[model samples]
Target chain A: MTLAPFEGADALVRRNNISSQGPEGAPAIVFGHGYGSSRQMWRLVAPQFVDDHRVVLFDHVGSGGSDRRAYDRGKYDSLHGYADDLLEICHALGLSEIVYVGHSVGAMIGCLAAIAEPTLFDSLVLVGGSARYINDEGYVGGFEADDVDALLDSLDANYLAWASTMAPVFMGNSDRPELTAELLDSFSKADQAVARQFARVTFLSDLRSDLSSVSTPTLVVQSTNDIVAPVVAGEFLRDSIPGSRLEVLEAEGHYVHVSDPEKLTTTIRSFLG
Target chain B: MNPGVQARDLFDLIPCGLISATTRGVITTVNDTFLAMVEKKREEVVGHHLIEHLTPGSRLYFETGFMPQLKAHGRASEVAFDLCLSSGETLSVFLNAVVDRERDGGTILFAVFDATLRRHYERELLAARRLAERSETRVTILQTATTAFGNAGSEEEVAHALADASRAATDAMAASVYLCDPSGGFSAPSSSGAAKQLVEAALLDALGGRGDPSPTGGLAQSPTTVVYSGSAELSAHFPSAAAALRTARVEALATVPLIDDGALGGILLASFGRPRRLDPPTVDLLESLAQQSVLVLQRIRLRELISYRSLHDPLTGLPNRHSLQRRLDQLLTGTHPNQPTIAVLFIDLDGFKSVNDRFGHLAGDSVLRRIGASLERAVRSGDMVGRLGGDEFLLICEDADEQSAGDLAERLRATVRNTPLEEATGLSVSASVGVSIYRPGTSPEKPTGDALIQLADEAMYQSKRTGKDRATIIRA
Candidate 1:
């Protein structure tokens, strides 16, 4: 009936799988990984801010080294659980007026965090984020509700099969060979039960209202030839959030962070400046 | 050697695949060794991100683990990734990289090692470990189900316990338990069941859509299991049921037959939120649970049957004299606040000796059976009707007054006269009826049922003395 009171820095780090670099007093740039990869998606882009800004990288509780025991089905059933982690990390580090960079589902998670505590973030960068994955009466999220169900069923197979079939599509950069492999390894890194729950939470979420509520300046990055979040999804995010700019990347796939980190860093930097 | 010869030699040979990439992770140079390993030329290897050649999982490893560590520490070592060779074969490679920083950004140096042999055993071990974990989980689930069945109190509870355990173990959305009733119908599904329409449809489909209500004989010999994945597969077997399941968005169903000593006792139905493949160990454990469930469930049913027979008339399936007395005793102890006078009736056949003496006891027995059925039909909804002995019957009616009791007694006297005995067609049959009403005001204390029955017997004798097929009433 009662939850343990939220612990500060040490507990937040353990719960959210947080890691950081750069000078302590500098402005913070919090980076969130999407479904497939962990904070490594920000490797090529994060180093750009290492000189003057603090680069904070953390995996969602189930994805990386975060304590799996802390994962309660009731708490993590919604995206708010993930967003709360972001806020906790900010408060723990005494970070104010930070930039939140989120990829795919993480974008919506960041938006949720910003809406809850708008003072913590000054700018939001969402790459390939979609408000809803399932197409409603007039939406195109590239999948039906049943398709995601089917995908979860497919994940019921062994890790090898899941890695082979899912990694390519999630990485989406077929022209490059290593990205898919990297994604597969990332998929294998997660606990089986956590991975399955993450898939359900990420694909089944509907967070359109959260976008409009984000008071921070936002940028929506749409990648060309993206299969997961199509051009319309980017447009939806931009249109839903007030005063938000939409940028189309030259890269492709759901993992724009892995495929086109340079473009992301450039666009995000320009928007923040 | 000339400078040109030295440069050409450097490009020709190396111990391992050597490659270099710009700070942006785009490959800008490749040696001959690197080209041969990927089975590509220098031009093909250059000007492309080395990320493209790796498998999806390895791509993830590079981006999430290897690349970040490489950037943070300025060096990454012993990174394993599977690369897609030009021949469509994926090669497992162990990579080590070092960043070389200069005036114009920095270049990344990489060394690749072939790790096919090491990786083969690692993958095999991983699969074996997973199988072991799966079996361990299944063992725990079976232990829980076995314990539940061993301690069950009733047939329905056993079904419920097993369904609850299995659904949680397998992560199923809903579960149902069904037992075959003797009259070619199944009992109402247990509480653990899913939505009515989906379960009904799935039950029908699982049984191959046969109209026969007795599912015991309906099961197929081979496989001993029926599994439907998704609506399409389920539709192929039971179209109507599949339609209902689809409407409920149920993706999978598995029906395991519960056979006790080779006889069908019942069935266990499991519904899933998504299509699933039933693993062998899971299927085996389910079958074991099915067998155990039926054994317990059948035992409960037999116990129930024994209890039923103890208090019910064998021939007519009505309450016997013992059950009727118990009913009256319970009624007296818990009499309602607005209790009406309780009436007890005694009826005796009048015609009897002539037909029995002429056509024999068998003919008289049929008449007795016919009269017994008629007595039951003549009583009110809450009345208790039972056979006392040869040619004698009793009725315990609640809320009956003197006028109503007399009217019921008249109805009882005419019941035998209305239908002639099947064997003795020429003979007419009738009964003498007597009623005793126990009004609470008649006595200060609660009245006993034995006194009322005694009074009713005397009243029946009075009716017999006056004229055979008539009614008499006595108020107590």
Candidate 2:
């Protein structure tokens, strides 16, 4: 059956490049992507929810198909700015009782939005999330201040490579050239300046104080051997947020949604029920 | 040439390091050049994550930035990283990699170039470019500040313009100008941005004299600009100020003293919210701003002094007769609803001629100066008191009628009587006071300032004829 992505899209939907599908008048499930990735990262997992819920996916500003001009450095200096954009998108679409599934930085964006408006979200699924990336006195955040600075340097060093990576990779599979092209196109559209600043904001931001205020039911999904967000970070998220549970996936790597989509989808489905 | 044999030889003998690794970055194979560059054995290199051989920063970049791009696009090129060698040194390397994909994962081939010379050159170029940009910003700030100061009519406006210009030049979170008072201490600062608390805390630290050594150090030894970058650096110099900054989440401070011609004109303070090591160029910009502001402030003060001398009595420092006439004309020209009547009180000292003859002209000048000060104190805030040459003084008041003006005239007569001639023993002074009242929209004819003064002089003669130490009132 044919699934119309933007059947009844509005201004916000067009601006954020939102793609929606599912039965009408169904409970909505929105997916937010993390740093270094966009809405395309949700490709393997989001479709599983379409049978029962209205699945919505959109790119954050300066990433994917979202309008790059909307990226204001002052406004997006903190994650709250991204939360404001998310709330605006949700309000424009008239979506409430939302099941928000966010990964990495997007997870904190969801948490912030949920804290600002508790009644709008029914639940939150945080994958590979950390409140703070830098290790404090007692916290094991898996990184240091110097590491974050190095990450910014890395961004500068890779600017040329990232800009030129738009060329499509057609090794052996020539039949599915369009799919590969679309993926690369969205990945290449991410503004380099925005990505650099976003990295700084994401790594330097400390949301430990804001976590205890979250009232929505949450599911912290973590992966084994995840370098960015370790198991301790997942446990911290679960303990800090009220009524939240932690689930450790048997997968390896930070991107659990991409590494093991079936397991991630099953866990999300179980949690929603 | 045999193709397979030539390719094998070329791979081992290549100048750059080459490696094959798993998608997860675990090295599976490495050429001879790669082993020689890292100064490691083949076994030590293989079966370890490629990130282990890289510096912390490059490792982070590879995983978080480069790896993701490589995974999505199947290739990445010209990515720079620093590889840690076994000899306790780093190799600045640029990599070009391609992934051979499988159903679930992939193997990757990486070509690494030693870019030590290139990286060094690039850093030099970047620093030069940044210096050029900062120089341009400094010039623009000075130009804008010069224009603003040239147009500034008052000291407060100059202070504001300097504050704004300094903040823009330094990219500070907040900037302020603390003017020097006559007592040689700084006055309350005129600020250009928010975070007044941060400025206040920093100002206290600056004025506390921790930075200045040898209390009597004159202009030559005075510190030009004192910059503290982080909490530790700030705490080392000013502990309490650092504590205050910690509470405000401020991390950097630069204090530039505005000095001109061996006198402390004022001070400029710039603060930052993030930990920042302000380079030498930024410090230079602060000093330049401070110098420009000092020159502008000097100009403003000089102009103010000249204007003050022109319209004021040199002996008593009271407004001269010319200034009084101009003020009276201005008051009479305006028309408004419920306008108050303007009253002019003219007074002539009764016994001043005898005191001048007895105690010399210096004593007479001292008595005039004392009376000028007393009259200035006696008048209302909006009233103007002026000396109209030799034993004559004028007082202008708004919102006064005939009865109130007569009362004020009597008070002035008493003030003159109570004047103690210190140099001449047993000598005292009194005044014959006259008042003229003018009501707007009520009088038959409007009188000019000279005519009004003449009428008051006639009334003063009437007071003198009747009795000394008395007042007379007349409506003009």
Candidate 3:
């Protein structure tokens, strides 16, 4: 009868599919993934930090191995709601002066969390992020409202294809059973409604006004070319957020951690130092 | 043709597109079919990144979503994409790609299918699904409204249910219920949402002649429902209202008339922040919500009418004998320092029989109506004036002593004598008035309405015996 099976801040760790490694009590660094991805995205970059820090990784609800039942439409309607969840995860782990790294939508979520509770995060690492994706009168966010609509439609088209064809594709990889299970788990946990709503919230939300209030020391990481969050978006983020620095990496594609993990890890390590 | 040449031809002329690229998605080679599908020459596509060939949306999905799966599983299947063609329009394509990891840095081999028909089918399926969801939501809203409206005990509750239902059904930013007021203008009875002023203005403009609640006509006759797709249409129809809405940034609106018994009773209006056009089913659902409101409103009015009729006289529209009895019981039961005395004036027409005999029954009825009006004016504002059938009438007044009761009786007689019934009927009539007074603690028996009326009736007969058109007073 209880729709929310897990209650209180303590349950957030398990509910968010949280995992931690490296030296305990060391300065913690949490890694958050972007839309349509899981915490596994940071496999290559996060290990480099684990040598010196308590590395934390968790999937947002409705992605990865997180409790699929915990995905509430009302709770995750806006990025602020996701921010609340992020704050809860941080608070549950008793993390303070945390070095937070977030990619894509995760970057905005981190910004919101930092704006709400600046003391909790020492600084923020926003990778390939945009303050806003939809274009405004004077701002160029690289997309129109109609384009976002089409993006949602494309999500639907791909999701329908992903649900059926992905299983057979995974079955072919029996040589790596563990990876096969992980890939299946990642794709299987996705609900179409959640993906669509998440897409809408991610693309349509405008966080230009929130940037100035961010007191946390921030680093905006931009790829040389990213289709989702363009170079201008990272520049805008750097300009709008108070005292934030921008690092344009000589990387390609949206997922900098995936395309060039060495460059992204080195950027964060240097930013932290 | 040689077997090797034929094998090469089969690869180039395959039904689907073929591509070989590095795992990083840079194209290494493409077959003839792939070039033909994208409407690009072999030289143009051979070295380009696959993401560049995709539409922006598809490119985002490919880089973030598709590539990750491809890297992790060594292959990805049935990923949908919209390939940006040479002509600036997109061609829907379904792709299946596998990785050859034995090669340096790995090599990606891809098979692309032109899926224009499949995309068309999928879009239709999605539309169907959306329609089904909307229909289900509409039905649920209607069901909830039906229960809420049916259980509502007052008009305000009904209006509240209506506002909720209309807003839910349309998913509008705001919804308001406006009732037809006595001043002939519409007044907002209930509202739901923050954009109250915007909705009010939209309603005012959309329903021209805002103050004119002309029954069975006006805005109601022109269209039972009004829809403005966006601000422009709203401006075209209602410039001032649209101006207010524009200030609030509201873009769409739909209003349905609440008609009861062929008369416009009110209106249900919903406003949206996005440019919207209500599909046929949605429009029908809105009208159904309006109809529900109308039914509830009619029920309320009917209940009021029935209650009024139960306690009123058919002819004079005054409280009848039954109503007077209830009022007498109320006045006699309570003890108050402000009004300790109760007076009942029992009046009978002294010359009414002659008027009826001479001027017929129609004139008698007219004289009775006029006499009722005069008696009403002669009594104090707090007094209850009612007819006890035939020629008898009673006036129940509180805070009246023997002197005030006698004075009021005299005033009633004089007012009846001064009445203009004689001019119309060629006859003059007057009233023989009797007064009965009761003071608490003075009377041995507690006063009842029937006992008070009997004593007043005896006093009236005494006035009739002494002389017609005279007043008599009795203290009980």
Best by lDDT: 3
**What tens digits encode model 2's per-residue C-alpha lDDT throughout A1-273?**
123333444666656888878987799999999887889899999999999998989998877777776676545655766887899877777788999999999999999899989999999999999998889888989888898887876776666677667443322333665566556555444466578767876887777867998999999999976878889999999999998999999886677888789999999999988
| TM-score head-to-head 1 vs 2, winner | 2
Poorest 10 consecutive residues of model 1 chain B by lDDT?
B208-217
By TM-score, rank the candidates, best first: 2, 3, 1
Q: On residues B1-476, what C-alpha lDDT tens digit does candidate 1 reach at each position?
A: 69998986776676677888976577877788778778887777788778778754455345433554465457766566778888999887777788998824789999987878976776677668768877777778778887888788888789888787667555566677776666645666763534354556455555742234443535634326777755557667666566566445455678877776775566677776444557777777787777778778878878889999988887667788789789878878776546788999998888888789889998988878888888788788999998777778899998899999999988888887886687887888788888888876566677777878888989999999998788889888
Q: Interface RMSD (Å) of model 1?
A: 8.8
Report, for every candidate in turn, its global Cα lDDT versus the true structure.
Answer: 0.74, 0.80, 0.81
lDDT of 2 by residue, B1-476 (tens): 89999999899999988999987777998999999988999999999878878886776677677877887888888898989999989998899998988724678999999899987776677568556855777788889988888888887888889888877766566778877777645677788755466546454554553334456443225646777765567667666565566555455677787777875667777766544556787677778767877777788889999999889999999999999999999988883546899899998998889989988999889989998888887778898989999999999888888888888887888777776667667887889988888888776567888888888888889989998788888888
Clashing pairs in 2: none
Clashing pairs in 3: B184-B211
Clash counts for the predictions, in order: 30, 0, 1
lDDT value, residue B465 of candidate 1: 97
Ten contiguous residues with the weakest lDDT in model 3 chain B = B209-218
DockQ result, candidate 2: 0.23
Candidate 3 lDDT, B1-476, residue by residue in tens: 69999999999998999999986788998999888888999888987788889887777678766887788777777888899989898899999999998977789999999999988999999889777877788889899999999988878788889988887776566778888876877765587754467547555655674454456444756547878876668777676575576545456678788887777778777876545677788889888888888888789878988888888887777789999999999887785445579989999987788877887888788888888887788778988999998899999989899888888998998988898986346667788888889987785678688899999999999999998799999988
What TM-score, over all chains together, does every model reach?
0.60, 0.70, 0.61
Give RMSD (Å) of candidate 2 vs. truth.
Answer: 8.0
C-alpha root-mean-square deviation, each candidate: 11.5, 8.0, 9.3
How many angstroms is residue B451 displaced in model 3 relative to the true structure, after the best TM-score fit?
18
Which residue runs of candidate 2 sit more than 4 Å off their true CA positions?
A: A1-273, B1-48, B68-75, B86-89, B97-117, B120-123, B137-153, B180-188, B196-228, B231-247, B256-267, B336-338, B419-425, B442-446, B465-468
